[model samples]
Target: MTKFADIKGFVFDLDGVITDTSVLHGTAWHQLADYLGVAWSKELADGLKGISRMDSLEMILKAGGKENDYTPEQKVELAAKKNTNYVAEVDKMTPANILPGMKAFLDDIRDKGYLLSLASASKNAPRVLAKLELTDYFPEIVDPASLKHGKPDPEIYTKGAQLLNLDPAQCVGLEDAAAGVQAINAAGETSLGIGDATELGAADMVFADTSLVTLANIEKHMA
Candidate 1:
């Protein structure tokens, strides 16, 4: 039997995994931080990865010692502003923006008969996939609006497995952030992190980048 014999589905995180829209997200957040008179840093931007819009906003506010400055209503407006900026950038993406080897990896997984689903914190996931013309590859995308918790909570990853009609243990969750990897592991899925190994040490496996995320590589590591 293959090393992934029991795995029936693959759950993917958007942003850094399927495409390079992370910079777009960062730009949007930076714009919002500027509007709020908050100083932004690369470290703060890094912490926002794999987290929800509200969560990211909250973190940014706290980093600037302005967490209590905005009322709940103002926070909502700020988040909407950020999303508006993000969607504007996302609108410019094309299929060519799909990460190296990611398109081929999706094709290969589908050809091999494994189900595919997405578990993204971004509300613009559908738009992003559509922009990249990769919607058909993922039959299910767990709705971020339906979840009560975000990454590092396991709610999203667990919902992803349910959407694929599989148990968490029977699925492989791919992510490029520490929070996402932690969420996948908490959900009982085999976690594959697609970035720095040390940063995503919670994952069951780690690939340097999407270009290295081939069936052969996955199986070789699992074996």
Candidate 2:
């Protein structure tokens, strides 16, 4: 086992990592597609994971053979509608909705004084954290709206490390999507991939279940 004792900070991707909001996001996207009379499937929504909402919208448009049909403003409006749908479920979130092991893992890291940053592709990250009462663990959170690109691009992870005053090499990134794993690696950090190992090839380690994400386990696997 590798000793990850040298790691000083942790960068976490939202959605699938801290909470199960991916289903809500996928539902919202599907609703928008139906409302717009466009075709969308769960498989297509799967591609939107770890990606920005507008970028997801563009993909949807292209899937519908209408990518160039809508002007930028129109696409923005549609994306806003999708966001509205997403927010309706925000109020439903409570601490209980946080993954089984996330709260404990976060508490452990916080107690250890590990600098933590939440890098989410969702602009709703702030609200989600507030609703889940997990905002205190994250002093720095990347606003996807501010970024011109989304995951698979290393900007978010790099900025996360920068905000923590740590070198990317001194941080480990946790994500549940392949693009996010790539982002972490691209930023020169070790990547912890949650969920499917087959889908997270870019990660340094993959855990199918969250229950095993303890500090000891992380150190062992991420070392």
Candidate 3:
């Protein structure tokens, strides 16, 4: 059990950790792939986790052998289209889309006086936060637009901790992607891995889903 006594705050990855937006992202990618006549699979989409939207577009285009002809402007346009689709889908998300026990955990943490922040590679993070009505929960949002590098580099997480006025060791990072877990670990913070355990082998702790990540569970680890 990892102790949370030293932790002063919590930082979360929006897409998979807070909401079921991973499926929406994958769906949007597949839609774009079909429009571009590219082969897009869940495996490829999964591999693109924690990367920026532009980078993801480039990867998918290169994989489809269509990277050479597409202009930068075209790539931007396509990415915007994907966002449009994603936004429409996100608007339809009800409370049901929020992972189980996440609300309870978030309430507990906030009530306990832990500062909360959001660190995500998504450029549309602000929009997503607004749409989900989760804007009030996070005081600081360090996103792709705020950093030169994305996950696997630890810059985002490091900056997040800096913005929150908390030490890396005093923050708990929650993520569902392996890259995110790596980023948290590299930042010297405790990472609670959510979702599929096989992919997040590097996480300090693993839970099957948000439902397993209760305040009691966190306290137990901290103890």
Candidate 4:
């Protein structure tokens, strides 16, 4: 078993883990789909989780049989348009938007001297953190804009570990998306899932949501 004293840090995925921005993202995608005259629903929203902006657009396009109709440049523009809508929604956000059990949990982690970082694929991570009054909790926020690849690629998680000066195996990653969990595990850390059990099947240990990923359970993964 991995012991508590052996772990060096904890890295968390943003969006669903830190706050419920999934709905905002899904709304943006739905708006894009509406503009494309494509029917959008939660099922389509499910495919957007943990994916890049353009990738989500492509998925929606493919569902509408228009994936190949647009050039890469056009796709980028469309994705940017959708992001504008999401940003407007995010601007309305406040600190209460922080997810349940997160503030106290993060405080406890810091109190225990465990290095904490945020490894989000969102280019607006810093903005969101500031809006939620969470900027002080993480000194190292991996630059999502610098990533050529997103979750499930392990690049973000690896960068977080590097920024913290910790080995991947000596860290733990918390996520609410299957792709994020996969990225965490691929980076050699314990992947703690924070969502539906069936959806996060790849995680080392799955919790229903942020509230359930208790410190006791977290320490159990240390080695």
C-alpha TM-score for every candidate: 0.84, 0.84, 0.84, 0.83
User: Where is model 1 poorest over a 10-residue stretch in terms of lDDT?
Assistant: 1-10
RMSD of 4: 2.8
Tens-digit per-residue lDDT, 1-223, candidate 4: 4456778899988878889888788787788899988888778888887666777898899999998899999988998899898988788889899999888889888998899889987788888898898999999999877898877899999988998999998888989878889899889888889889999998888888788767887765443
What lDDT score belongs to each candidate, Candidate 1 first?
0.91, 0.87, 0.84, 0.86
Task: Give the clashing residue pairs of candidate 2, or none.
Answer: none
RMSD of each: 2.9, 2.9, 2.8, 2.8
The digit string of per-residue lDDT tens for model 1 on 31-101 reads: 98998898989899899976778999999999999999989999999999998999999999999999999
Which 10 consecutive positions of candidate 2 have the poorest summed lDDT?
1-10
Clashing pairs in 3: 2-221, 2-222, 3-221, 3-222, 4-222
lDDT per residue for candidate 3 within 1-223, as digits (tens), equals 3366778999898877888787888888888888899887767888887566899999899888888978889989999988888878777776677778888888889998989999987767777777767788987998576688767888888988988998899889999888889999999989889978889989988898889998788777667
Clashes within 3 Å, all models in order = 0, 0, 5, 4
**Which model scores highest in lDDT?**
1
Global lDDT for candidate 4?
Answer: 0.86
RMSD of 1: 2.9
